[model samples]
Target chain A: MIGIVGGLGPYGGLDITKKIIDETAARSDQEHLPLLLFSCPNLISDRTAYLLDKSNVNPGKAIAAILRQLEMAGATIAAIPSNTAHAEPIFSVVQDERARMGSTLKLLHIVYETVRFVDENYPDTTVGILSTAGEQICSLYREAFIRKGFVVVEPEGSQQEKVNNAIYDEDYGIKAQPVPIANKAREDLLLVMDDLKKKGAQVIILGCAELPLAIPERDYNGMIVIDPNRILARALVHSLAPDKLKPL
Target chain B: MIGIVGGLGPYGGLDITKKIIDETAARSDQEHLPLLLFSCPNLISDRTAYLLDKSNVNPGKAIAAILRQLEMAGATIAAIPSNTAHAEPIFSVVQDERARMGSTLKLLHIVYETVRFVDENYPDTTVGILSTAGEQICSLYREAFIRKGFVVVEPEGSQQEKVNNAIYDEDYGIKAQPVPIANKAREDLLLVMDDLKKKGAQVIILGCAELPLAIPERDYNGMIVIDPNRILARALVHSLAPDKLKPL
Candidate 1:
């Protein structure tokens, strides 16, 4: 069984689960992958808040706690869909906590998987990342792309601030609005994506979980939208239930 | 925390989760309810097959087992979204198992709660139920409606078969297809609804989880489509954290 460490913002967590279902070439309900999603939204604090030192609570312990529950419920492999949550402090603490508990649940690294997927498929491409300030400030995707010998570009200056508000603004952010998403959030994201496209971005990555919901389509006016959620989902399918996975 | 006993069919399980998110009047991600969904699609056998004596294995045992795990995971209230799973044998088995183990997990009765909602609002209404062979054969909703002094109606003969196919047929069934559903399944369901409308169905009850997915809108060409999943979600919110629930 695959464990989804969800509620890294509720819909964002479910985005991975939805993609898993979509990516799997299931002929019947039974043909789909068996996964458990633990989405205790209130239990885990904001990843960005913790990363930015706006909050003292490390969400890693709470996330690791949920991972432990998933394992207890029979998850053999697990994945956390949030890019911001994959920062070194939060991600490493979760790993260390799990290791201390001797957890055998193999947690798939979302950044590593996305970088590897890009290396094999779209090698040497200038990758544009649109994510929360947490992932950008942590340099999570940048470090991974550098290791993979690929150029990385992100929203610059006030454009980056617009990207953050598209995710974090209390009034019109993706997380604040209902599932169809707010017009302001979508517009802000589109403007930033256009900026990235002009910055010589051949490939675009939705590094934040909530961004994919805003830009649901993969084509995105020919920028080759790469959702790390779907990439992580493919990684999960390949790890254990390879046959259920569809050809990309 | 709420536990969702999911994978009665993966998408059906997710429909309730989606509804919960929709029904909650939350401003941001943290404001959304904390819920866990365990969707082990292959673990439990088909509910209809077992109900029809085509299989000896009772999915009740497996469902009950999952409920126990949900309790351990810190779910105070729980719900199974499938209509057929609420048929006496399976529903009671889960309750009995929880009782035998001294479990405090509150399992919401989707059918009963739905009927009560109808009774309180749409009093003396003639309800039309669209469900699987298991629910129809078991008379689960029929019994519940009868107890509430409400008139009940269902698709008769060939139309009933079409409804079943919309839910269970291997080719174009809702369970067999991916999200967005099959055109055939949706067409079949809309035809059945037309038939039900002709039969004097004042209120339409989407008794099966998958039916709600097909006919998502509550106001289906004027008939009030009573989605039990949404009703169940509201019941969960009401039982605890009533503040989060949007007024129905």
Candidate 2:
């Protein structure tokens, strides 16, 4: 069974969970895929905070524990939907924990899959990155795209603030209370996507799962919004049932 | 941690998971509750089919197995969101499984909690029941309400067909495909609510979780539509946390 190590922002995890069902070629309720979710929202430290500031406690150990818990819960392979949490430190922790437990719970690399999608489809097109401050600080998206031989454009400092506000603002942030989606946040996020388009970006990557809660699946402005959540779900489907991989 | 025994139907499981997040009073993601969800959608047989036909395979044993898996996954309390699957035989299976395992994973009763809400808030008011034919045939809602000293009213035969259509029809049924909520099904289900109001239903219980996907949570013809999903979420919240029960 596919396992989800979620609650890295509850809405982001829930978004992936819902998308898995939407990604399946299920006509009946019974046709959907089986998913085991360990949604421990309270356990892990804040991803952006830990990555942004040295004083903040790192969530690597906590994430590792959760992954082990998912493995114990009968998850053959797992995906953590938090974009910022995919740093080298956290990935190392996951690998170490799996090795120690002798568990074969494979971790789906969301960024790798997203970069591959860009490499295969967009090829030489310039990609714009819109994600958390932590993701930017850690250079996760920048490094991934650079390795794929793709030009990456980031929002200007002022525009980046708007993106952060759309994701972390108390009143309207997608990660803020009363979530899943918000209209005002969606409109604000659209403005950021528009800004990215003006910077010669042909494809935009919603590197963070929380971003998609504000941004719709339809093309952002005219640029294609590559949601990591959908990409991860598709990758998961292909991993579990390769033969059934034909446009879920 | 609260464990959700889901995939009785995928959307029904997702609905409850999203509601738990929505009902929480967390200002940040860290304050939300931890939820472990085991959503093996294909594992169990169809609830309606089995209950309505003796020839059909019973899902009781399969559900019990899923619950056992949830218990193994470290869920202290559990809830299954399928309304029709709340029959006596199912409950007995759950109890029997827990007994055999010597586990204390308490199962929350959605139907009982919903009836109690009506009994406490709209006492002595005539209540309308809109649900699957399985629920109606089993007299789940009617029996629950009558025992609580409240008058119960079901749809007329012709209107019942519309209710069933909204729930089972492929293009628009809540459980059919492409779910959560549907517009045309919502409009059709609202018409049934209007009929219930005409028959002196002071309050309406969305007896099935899928029904709410078709019917919006608003007063229908001056009647309060009591959503069992929301009721079940509230009940779950209370069971997990009695001290935090102010307003969600």
Give the backbone clash total of model 2: 0
Chain B alone vs. reference chain B, TM-score for every model: 0.91, 0.90
lDDT of 2 by residue, B121-232 (tens): 7899999988774754338778988988888888878888888888788887766744456676788788888888888998998877767666666576789888887878
lDDT of 2 at B3: 84
Write the residue-wise lDDT of candidate 1 on A120-222 in tens digits. Answer: 9999899898877475433878888988888888887899899889877889987677466999999888888889888888889888777887887777756
Query: What TM-scores do the predictions have?
Result: 0.91, 0.93
**DockQ, cand. 1:** 0.68
- lDDT for each candidate structure: 0.84, 0.78
Error of 1 at B61 (Å): 1.2
| Residue pairs with clashing backbones, model 2 | none
True contacts kept of each: 0.63, 0.92
Q: Which tens-of-lDDT digit does each residue in B34-120 have in candidate 1?
A: 899988778888887877888998898889888888888888999998888888777778778878889888888888899888998
Clashing pairs for model 1 are none
Lowest summed lDDT across 10 adjacent residues in model 1 chain A is found at A131-140
DockQ metric, candidate 2: 0.85
